[model samples]
Target: MAAPPLLHRHFSNSLSSPPLHRHFTSSLSFPSPSMRPAALEPNLFISPKPSLNLSKTFASVSFENQRRKPTSFAPASHASDSEPESRENRVGEAREAVAEYLQKYGASREEANCVSSNCPSYLSMLIDGVDDLDGWNSLAAAAENVEFKRKVSQMAEQKGDKGVLPFLESIGLSLASASRLARYFSPSKSNALPRLIHKIQARRGGLHLLGSENASFGYLIESFPRLLVLPLESCVKPIVLFLEVVGVPKECIRNIILLFPPVLTYDIDTDIKPRLRSFEKIGVKDTDLGKMLVKYPWILSASILENLEKILDFFDEEKVPRSCSSQAIKSWPHILGCSVSKMKLIVEELSKMDIKSKKLGHVIATSPQLLLRKPQELLQVVSFFKELGMDEDAIARTLGRCPEIFAANIDKTLDKKLEFLSNIGISKANIPRVVRKYPELFVCDVDRALLPRMRYLIEIGLSKKDVGFMVRRFSPLLGYSVDEVLRPKLEFLVKTMGRPVRDVVDYPRYFSYSLEKKIKPRYWVLKSRNIDFSLKEMLGKNDEEFADVYIGDGEVLVPPS
Candidate 1:
């Protein structure tokens, strides 16, 4: 429903490709058409960038590091029985075998011949490397209906004239995918007219419920092309309806499905609810579970319960409360799937950094994502701060305050924010001060969020040097919205309060207080009493302290409506 990510039309171009369902590679590789079926097994999670790009720039994840192991369970699918023809072809035999395999698997002779003639290489690619029947059965199981085998047989009998090929071509599936999928429809591989009719029925019914026909359906279909003929009530509706029942909005169903189509394969009672309960037990409110799943749908699809228990044990061993890890997982559900051994490496690295074991749980809870970061990446932040005059405790505080900075590659976020500061006249020596003041500064977008605020301040009569000092003093001023926070507050200070804008150079924290709530009421309180106060002296005091000091304790002054 969010724009499709790579859609993997590239699946048809290369035989080594992962077909339609494999995870995106470092290069954002999508499965080619030939690979989609074999890809459906083993590789269960696909990290599509469109919906789940969630903040790649949060820190530095070398895109290479982003490539997850395909979580292979079956033997690998690359064709290896290379004969002298370059695993190429002996003219007749491979085609015969491919056509035979297609028919044995349910493709009719006519349909198989049509597919074999069109995509000989794609068909031939299967026989050598994969256990085609085993792979085909797995595809059959994905449809999950009692009628699946009978459906496959019926599809196999369709003559070339009546097959589902035209419907597939119209849907924009690649030729290899169409050819492979045409036979694979045990509801999965065939191309009967019934299958096309069912696809239309699904598009109008269940898929229409998912929100977009043009964009999301195309991506979803590519992942599980067989989903067309799957029993709507048992296979499709249950998953979509269960998401709604679990508090996922009707609109968001496609996002979870598009990110990991295997969520469709997971059984509602055994698989889906158990995973949902795992998070529920961890203190995830029922309302928040849908959001967490949307953020990381793999939470349901991946074999996470075993690893989740291991992580809970890790948290307990570290003396962190189970509740603490719950908060961590809410922020980063992917951590639920991380191995404890991999986590231990990170803990040991932090331990060597003089980070106390007592603080590990809280630190991770504050930024659950840090557990996924390589210790080297964490050290990258430490090494950077060490170079910047922060000691171990200082580095811990900086990273603990903005743990996202822990993985920020020196080449990107950390470096870019620092460069943005420099461009706005923040000196190199003063950057650590700015970071210490607001470590969240490292994560703000340089051009979009940070720079415009700085430019607005400088535009409003503060010299660039004044802003440099103010930012070094209160760097979060850069993070505030200009339309909402910056412009209105500056207007009040100079035009309404009649204070020099230079007063803000002395107290950038002026932007930190609410305008109508604190600033306006307090300023009018002081003004009615005919008293003057500096920006800091007026706004910095606690309400009782300010009242006791400025407004008499018993005095009732309604400042404004």
Candidate 2:
């Protein structure tokens, strides 16, 4: 094969010279004075040398020559007046100069003029810094920047599409990126560049696939410009449809692609669908797939039986219930991508702290994300709770109830929860009791969950001290929503049941009862029978036990069918 284009070789040599002046004078010159040199005239092509202004350089030389001697060829009166005519002659000479140079290198008159008009900078880049020309085509292959030439040449070499180089450059692809993308595929495909460019234009609408945030579109393209060349129907569409079908919103699609562009290359049937099926088979619900993808889009492309099955099988071996298995893994599918050995390491770390298999499984089922976090981090959280005076057994229990506390900011969440309790007069000594009794309290938002319920209790006539004592006694009250649970039940107790404010303060556990199942039915039955029951009697007993004790051979009236 002939060596690649000399234009590339010549330009590379020229650009490597020490200074701007050396690029033109040292690397390039005219064959004869009759053939006007392109270097002395900037109009032939835009000079690549930033500092060498062609007209100024030539004019200064002309001025020095004029000072050295009077012109013998021109009459004395017209010598100075000939300057304007000389400039016009240079402009006329520029077009002929460009044409003659390109023609000498095998371009026809039309090709020469077209090349000059369209890419004026390209010829200067081609020959300005070049040296030691071998032949008419020598400049074509003389570029030291082989990578860029190879990229542009690959497109031009394709049958019927010599315009591909300029076409590609016209798009946003930089020459460096084009060269890199050229190497991303095989060299034998002479038609690859045209096909790639055609594919990009064919799927031009894919730009809109990045959704309302066009900013990510730039990022996605810049990150993986080659993705534009992927087969729209065969490659990109299947992955897009799979994600959309799985509930990844359109707005999130760009971010997913940005995070994992190789996902587009995954074989939809063999790679993507199977992994998706494995996720579903492992118990990740379709509804939760969106959440999973948002957090770890790479999971969609993870090896199914290799990665996901290892997690599911491990959970099975740990006796994670079949019912809870899907919920657990869906809670954090990113952990499914973690090496099983790393998961075992996490489990082993937890076990060292006395949180063993069953407890570990339960904690994982509730917060499988725990498997994503480092075992060391979890241990630190455990130590933090321990520093708060909780023993191993208490921490283990707290993990079972609120595994997310291990993931939360202990400084913010744990301190805030303790601080709220302290403010409510629960005392520093009693915080562990509150946490041990209700670990969920540490995870609940203090502004949203804790304050409103306590305030509602005071509104219903319990003193602040009495409400604080009730919370310390039954810490679960911190988990109930005031608008949903506490307020309605208190209204019923005060109005419907005619229970005095004093009675509720005395037995504040009344807030913990299921208002629908226990409070409403039992209270209705007792009230209808014209019998009175204390809050404790009504709430403490199961239905059968309450009926056996309170009804006393009279038919235990059931909740009205």
Candidate 3:
């Protein structure tokens, strides 16, 4: 191919001066093709030295005379030479200047053409003696103008993918600009948490995009505490994913709120259970569930409980069940143990049900006391049992040896066993059995040890029949045979009044007799309606005294004292 046109010959000459000049001289038979005198003939080189000196002296005098002359003096004289430029003409000249300048910087004609057509005024100003740095700085000042950004983006697109970063950089876009563009292009989802999480995971510094006003995004960002003020939700998944992907320790995630959307009901028959089980597979614990429950109490809606019931039903329906209803029941205690309000709600709800809901009812019943106790106390009990590492059956058997602990003062006796319990690592649940089997151990007054056991019994809220059976079991430990302990008077008092013998034993003889007599009439009236008119009349006459003695609403009568 023939030699290419020397479009950037000046810069090329400066770059490859020595070799190119030599090549040009040898190939073209020219002393200096590029350096030839401007508009001079070949004969000028033939002049003698003295003639050349005289001509140079004359030329110098002429240049000095021209410099002294005023340009306005010749304005009308050289009408053809002076271009009459209007405002439009001036703008055209400016455009030409810019085009020439851009050409010198290696901008192709097509690229310059596109810029000129899109922003003629800007292009004109850009090339009017402005350096590359000044031109770009001016452009940057107008960067926020939608029209300017669009044109720049179009130019970059024309150059294809490789030009994107360079074009943006030339316009003063740093990493932050690229991110802003990305955000503008990809507006976050309605619930931006998942999208923000993905971005944070994909980009090392992506979390910085989260801002305080964008709380949803901020929540996710906060998941990475080292990165301040990120939305907790935005950071949550990434933190979770980081824990999963890189095996970060759970302790590192201490401050994050592990929120479960309130919409997620726990029905195993539905999608919720599988999702929960999946979370469990990834190391989420009952403790985690408990924490979520505590933090978002509203999540425990009726629907959630219904879903949990559905889960139980699913287990019941399965041939080889993955979960037992009983096991599911056991899990509820921890959830119910969250707060008094939650416990009360759970109990009230469960109490109204007549199905096979003992597990739920039991959990609800125990939860109030469990929550009321200090966490440290509960932890102590848990730790003690955990340290022993004995199986439940073994612990139950050991407890069977202590019956006196279950007697009238069962609540009082548990205090004495605390030391024993601590030494053996026995659990609190097992203490009741020990108290029932070995009542003698409960000989001590009600104290710390006894309180836990009493609380446990109260928590169970057993029916009268079950309570009687339990109380009778303590007979031998109380130094009485099982039959003697089951005497009619004791049984009647316990079953009917729900009071143990200890209360009657402590009462003064006169008071006890008075209460018994005062209560006897009402009890008889309730039992038999066939009592004569005369007896009814007498009972009515004593109604005020009966109210005073039994209901504490009126003055007691004293006649002929």
lDDT minimum window of 10 residues, candidate 2: 15-24
Q: Identify the candidate with maximal TM-score.
A: 1
Q: Give residue 79's error in model 2 in angstroms.
A: 43
- Candidate 1 Cα errors over 4 Å, as ranges: 1-206, 214-222, 225-229, 265-271, 513-533, 536-561
**Looking at model 1, how many pairs of residues clash?**
18
> What is the Cα-based lDDT of residue 293 in candidate 2?
79
How well is each residue in 1-561 modelled by candidate 2, as lDDT tens digits? 011121123223321111111111212222234334322222222212122222221222222222122212221222346676763443333334544544443344554454333332222223222212222255546544443323222323332223332223223333333343334332333443334333433444454555532233322443444454455457765667778888998778766766656576677778776776766675667788787777666565444246666667877786666656677767665565566777787777777756666777677778777776777788889888888888888887788778889877777787788778877788777878988888888888888778877787787777778877887888887677878887798788888888787786668788887788678888987887888778888777766677787787645545522
- Give the per-residue lDDT of model 1 (tens digit) for 250-367: 8778777766665666688887887778776788888888877776676664355666677787878877877778788887776765667778888888776555555776688787
| C-alpha lDDT of all candidate models, in order | 0.61, 0.57, 0.33
For model 1, give the 10-residue run with minimal summed lDDT. Answer: 52-61
Cα error of candidate 1 at position 36, Å = 16
If ranked by TM-score, best first, what sequence of candidates would result?
1, 2, 3
Poorly placed runs, candidate 2 (over 4 Å):
1-205, 231-238, 280-291, 302-305, 312-326, 458-464, 500-503, 525-533, 541-550, 554-561
